[model samples]
Target: MMNSRNFLDLEEVRMEVFSGKISRAYCYVLVKQGKIKAIRVGRKILIPVNEAARLLAEGVN
Candidate 1:
């Protein structure tokens, strides 16, 4: 079973949360700046769906 705290891969994250267009460089910056959340599982960066949603909402407000 998938864990509750699992995160989505960058491509999936971009396609879904970013409306199918987001820069790779910008994502790295966000990760470095900690504006968005990221978890390192092995060699990949993943962002949780809920966290991404919350961040997007926070931006609008």
Candidate 2:
């Protein structure tokens, strides 16, 4: 199982957390909006598992 300490890529977030309802562009927006905690590792954007869960539970609305 995934945990807070683990980091997930944007695609993983879309596939697993958001269920692909949101696009990569929106995911970038979410990171920019500061709704979710994330970091850039080279060309990839990664989010913490717990933060992703929090964002889902809270919703972007």
Model 1, 21-58: lDDT tens per residue?
66877777777788878888898998887777776567
Give the distance in Å from residue 3's predicted Cα in candidate 1 to where it truly belongs: 12
Cα RMSD to native, each candidate? 3.7, 2.0
lDDT tens digits, residue span 1-61, model 2: 2654588888888888888898889889988988777999998899888877876788765
lDDT scores for all predictions?
0.70, 0.81
C-alpha displacement of 2 in model 2, angstroms? 2.3
Clashing pairs in 1: none
For residue 43, model 1's alpha carbon misses the true position, in angstroms, by 1.0
Residue 4 C-alpha lDDT in model 2: 44
lDDT of 1: 0.70
